[model samples]
Target chain A: MSVLSLISGASIPVQLVMAILLLASLFSWYYIFLKVFTLRRAEKQTAEFERQFWSGADLTDLFQRAVNARDSAGSLERIFESGFREFTKHRREPGTDVGALMDSTRRAMRATYQREMDKLESSLSFLASVGSVSPYVGLLGTVWGIMNSFRGLANVGQATLSHVAPGIAEALIATAIGLFAAIPAVVAYNRFAGDVNRLAIRFDSFTEEFSNILQRQVH
Target chain B: MAAAAIHSRDEALAGGLALAMHVLFLVLLVFGVSWQHKQADTAVIVDLWRDLPSVTPPRVEPPPPPPEVKPEPPKPVPKVEAKPPPKPEPAPVVKPDIALKEKQDRERKLKEQQEAAEKKKLAAEKAREAELEKKKRAEAEALKQKQAAEAEAKRVAAEQQKARDALAAQQAAAQAKVVDEYKRQISAKIRRFIVLPPNVSDAAQVEFEITVLPGGEVLGAKLRRAANSTPAYDAAVERAILRAQPLPLPPDPALMRQFRELNLVFRPKD
Candidate 1:
């Protein structure tokens, strides 16, 4: 029998398990591509904004451009814009305490950083869950299918390889598909997770340096 | 704005690529497996050498009897009659034509020599008339010797002709016997496969004209006529003929040609 016929001929639970793995694999692949593009753009934008900020560009000029950019600003740019806007607002208000002003500005940047991290880390948990769970689901189907085949063997007077082979083969397809679904999800999850972590670290260091620059401006 | 729009649009592209990839994977799996199955189907090889080497006992039977009977008969014929000539005769019984040509050529040369001697005798008689009576007696003796030699050659030629006729008859008889023996062997082999029908008479016989290949495979078996028998018996005989594929025939191809198409009569009791 062909693999397709064998798969179609499998017991209901096994087929269900296969269907789940296939869907999980497809979704993982989609999330993988989505995260790739999202992280790539985030990294490129961070590099570009960092270069511009450090290029001896005027703070007020960069702030005006970032404000004009608004909803379309990158993660790091949005963080910079929010901090600078808060700094400007407190500076315009007379008798505002310098330490409190710096504290509120850092708070604003921290909130923006949290939002950016959320966007970069989106769908990552789903990838991690699929990678961890699919193999077990496939194993469960295989075990159940093998149990059913052996149960069927009780009625037959002679138990032969031919009697048991198709069932075992069908059952094993679940495990094969399970590994198929899990391997890439695991690999992509590991790679993308590392990338997001590195970006997170870069954002953290940027916030610290930005807060220091703001304190100097206040003095 | 462009970057944000492009980023938002990429989900569709990613989903399409993922779906296309899965479809490509499935096509590879399905076709790859089927291609492998096809390769396995074509790999099965039938060894013809297995069939060719085991020349069965029946195939060994027909050739020896003909050669043994054929060579023995002709040997005694030449030994009995050609003893008087004492000439070095090399198997004249087997090769009568060559021996006959050699004898004729020798006789011609003897006659030419006699003619030359007669001419010389006449010339000498004219030259010496007193010795004419002696020359006539000598010529008469030479004529007597020539007549005896001619008679001897005629007797030998006649004996050779008689031996040839006997040898041809013996060969014909041997061939007929081998053909009959092969027919019996074929009938016996077919009979082994016959499933005798119940209530069929021992007298009932079915005749079939069967065509066979060189390898003894029965190409076709046709009922020449329905025996005064039931259809079940006819079917039994037909099945038997088919089962007895490659019916036993003489190994000699010349003899085998006689068996290519045979009208076989099968009787249940026989």
Candidate 2:
């Protein structure tokens, strides 16, 4: 039987299930695309910002640059700006201890790091849910279809293959569509999750390295 | 700062490109897969039985040979009187000449009678055989003629039946067309007379049976179903059908049978 026939011949529940799966697949794809672009940009911007930070530019000048171009600043650059801003604010206090000042700067940077990570992790859960649950939804539709087809057999005196084949084919379509919805989502989720994790690690290491530089400058 | 601004612009451009790519991929997948599936669906399924070799007809058993007629046995030849003791050499001194000549003549006459009887019996046997052969030939000719007549009658009857069937189908089709045309005309006339209240929001349908006379006169009208609960609407529909008096009907009396008890449904639209 043709795909069209399989879809049209499916029971109402099966059709509804297929429709839901299709919508899920579409949304997953949209997120998959948007995340890919966002993650890649974050990585590139982090690398560029790191190169600029280490190019012997004065810390005060770098902080000014980050603030002036705040809208376009990378996540790593924003962390540096917040930490440096706190450092300069505390330094003007005549009796501020170096240890306490360093603590406040680290706290500010850590807060910014988490907010950026949260942005990166956004929508990853949705993709994971789609990947894991769509197949079961499709399975539910298939089971319903098969049950209906078998129930219909009670009306017949003798069941033949032709009588059962179309129903089964229609039922199987739900599973096929479910798998279609699931496979891509699962793949995209795994790949994006790995990318986000790697970016988070890079951001964490940059924060530590920047704090070490500040410690030396304070001395 | 300038570098960060430029990087952001690049990021936005990359996102736009990625979205376009995905949209393109989606369109291709939907159209490509469905189109391929449709092509596969159109494939023709050939019945293997259609190509099977033709079957030979079963052999018919030959008829049993005709009963053999036995020829009558020839009659036995009658015995001739033992030739009178070869005329004993009659001595000229013992018998008179007249007596000797009379005795020889009597012997010849008896031999002739025996030969004539033998020839007559042979002729009678030949005549009986000829009569039997003639009777067999006549019976065979009569049977052949009877079988030919029967086959001809069957063929003629089949042809006549086929012609009658074709004529009946043609008549039925023509009558149906006439009935449909008349029904359309009647509906159109009734539709012109129907009037619905302007405030009614929904379309309404009224089903009723109308009885008509042979000359296209409306004899009675009865409402069978009404979509709305309003009695006025049902009554209005009944009145419209009645006003369309002498519902258009085919002139053919035979076609009148259909219109005699017709079920009419009216759906009034704005």
Candidate 3:
């Protein structure tokens, strides 16, 4: 049998396995590109917001800009807005202490930080699962195919390489496709996960640094 | 909230990109497979039965007679078939109604002229009697023809069965003859190489099991039964067998099946 016939002639279970692996590969590539664009955008937005924050822009003006930019605002900008809004609301109270004001502001910023991180982290698990499990699915197809080929050998009077070559070839295609689907997924997952971690550290440091600024102003 | 909206747009974009990439990948996969397929598609046809240009003389005789006999019967069958239609068609035909109708018309005109009603009625009654007799005779003849056709069909069927049985027996005999012919040729070739030892007994026989390849090369020759004659005669026979390196074998694979492991009985006297 030829290469084309080998795939088309594969047993039903093997075909099913190949189909699942193909779909996994397709969706994983989709997420890989999507995450690439998204992570790049997040990193770019965080860098722009950080530059503007450290440029000594007025806090009230920055807060107003963040609110106006609402949907387009980056993770760091949103954390800054939530923290400034908390500080302003507590300052209106006549007897509110500096420690309590800073505490409430940090809390609001931390909450917004967590939500932004969640948004970035979405679908990363899907890539991880596909990367880790697709090889085994392909292995199942290979094992089944080899078993069927050997079983056919039992009926033949003379066992030859030609008898088993096609079946084994068809079975191996499963493993090849499995690796094909998994390598990119695993690679993309590691790259994106590392990028997201870097973003998280940046957001955490900004939250502590912004609290220090607000603490000095209140005192 | 704005992130979700932007995320949806990204999702749509990603979906479109994914679908396009998969389509491209599938096209590449199909093209690659079919490309590699060009070389693999060529088929090899092995010729199991090689035509023997030198061995044509013996095979020329047996096949012609059966073919000649088979073709001869069918050739003249259609051309000389003049018996069936004329014999059955002429006997059952009777035109009594036309003659009776004309007579009645003539009698009616005559009766009207002569005013004889009694004579016209009697003639009508006689015409009816004659028509009844003719119909009865036609029915009997038709029944006889149908019975004769049934008998002819049964005889033809019996003859066909006998012919089929004879053909099967002839095929079996032809196959046996081919096997015997190959065996004798192999024995003759080995005998030509024989340098017989003197003073061998008339009853001394040496039988060997000869195994041959498709190309008539002797793969092996083992002594199954040694000649009770002197050691020299036995050695001479074995030497002659080995000297006949490539034996004579039939070109047909079906005939070769019998010659694969041949039992050659070497009788010095005969």
Candidate 4:
């Protein structure tokens, strides 16, 4: 028999671990790829929305789209939907005090803004989990392999270099694989997570600016 | 008035959040894919461990037998055997002729001289003739007895010689047959015990030192080689040996003694 064949007979556990790690890596990369496109599109949309909002386009048309065709609406439009709906409802009610109307509408918009923020943060935690934990998981597998190797050596009367080498080498492979699976996830997680936070701040400021615009329209 | 302003700001914030959420999900996917690629690479390495060292002794042609030497015949030595001289032939004895006329005259004269001086001499000669006739009869009887004894001795010698020749031939044939059969059975048993692996392509020689008992029961197996200590490959090899228990034993009682401890090689060949 050739030397090559003897080395490649993989057992079940190693295969399993490798499969799992591969799955996780694939998921993370998929997430990264999908996020890259999504983030780019969102950025473009926000820029377009800001440009249109500041331009002289009619507010009624925008509001109708925000209310009726939500697909075209951004987070800004949803916030407008909440506050405008409440404002309109109050204005139509008989004997409704003006102060109460504005207060309630403002509160409603604020709540919607918080909801949208939560939505943005969804699945971000999962990325964090993968990034933070994968390396350690790989470490665990490596350690387990090494422990098994050592235990096997106990039965041997005189352990030689080759005897220990293969086991140790196998054990180390798990760690290397784990680290390989983890590093990119962490980097992507951090970068994407920061982007989410920054976008959130922009959303908060836009809500304030839109509220000021709404006040002008009411007066 | 504040409510209208607040509405616009809230809408803006909501739009920004939607954008951010999309980005986050995309990031997760990329990371997941990269991790998957790395994991696949690891799985391949584990496969390498399994395939490297096949545990079988490779088949090769047996070494050519040493050249035969033709020995020279020894020189002939001369044997000296001297021939003895031939014995002389015995002379035939002549019988005295009896005449009728001579018998009558002699009888008459004998009667006349019976009481005279010549009578004693005549009586002595007659007594001698009677004694000679008795001796001739005794000699004839002894000769017949000697011939009968010689015949009996020849028959006994012939029977003894035939029995000895038959016994020698039977013993030689029996011994040769027994030796040949014993050799044949032992060869078959040793050949039968060799095991080939399931897949031959990636098969390797996995050598083990195994100890067996006289009863064909395996006592122990020790791994002499590991292709790679990867858990997958190593565990599989050990399990294969255990599964191959109860090694082949020689048929003859005496031949079985030769297999108490031996080294076996496993090569997985299709």
* Model-by-model DockQ, in order: 0.27, 0.07, 0.29, 0.02
Q: State the lDDT at B19 in candidate 4.
A: 51
Candidate 1 deviant stretches above 4 angstroms: B2-4, B33-270
Correct interface contacts retained, every candidate: 0.50, 0.08, 0.55, 0.00
Q: What is the lDDT of residue B8 in candidate 1?
A: 69
Give the Cα error of residue A136 in candidate 2, in Å: 0.8
Tens-place lDDT per residue, model 3, A147-170, is 999999999999999899888999
Ten contiguous residues minimizing lDDT sum, candidate 4 chain A: A1-10
**Global fold similarity of model 3 (TM-score):** 0.53
Better of 1 and 3 by TM-score: 3
DockQ of 1: 0.27
Ranking by TM-score: 3, 1, 2, 4
In angstroms, the error of model 1 at B177 is: 40
Candidate with the greatest DockQ versus the true structure: 3
lDDT of 3 by residue, B102-177 (tens): 6676667655645445555566667667766766766776677667666766666676677666776766677777
- lDDT at position B252, candidate 2: 65
Per-residue C-alpha lDDT of model 1 across residues B1-270, encoded as one tens digit per residue: 666687768898789878987898788888776623444445665423223322222221221211111111111111112122223323324356677787787677667766766776666555555355556666776677667666766666676667666666667676777778778878888999998889888778789999999888999999988667778889999999999887877677876788889999887778
lDDT minimum window of 10 residues, candidate 4 chain B: B46-55
TM-score of 1: 0.52
Give the TM-score of each candidate: 0.52, 0.50, 0.53, 0.44
TM-score of chain B of each: 0.51, 0.55, 0.43, 0.29
lDDT (10s digit) by residue, model 4, range A1-219: 111222243235654665576567666665665565555555666677778778967777767767775654566667778887877788788887757877888898899888877766665676677788777777776677778778889989999887776776666666666676678778888888887777777767877787677767766
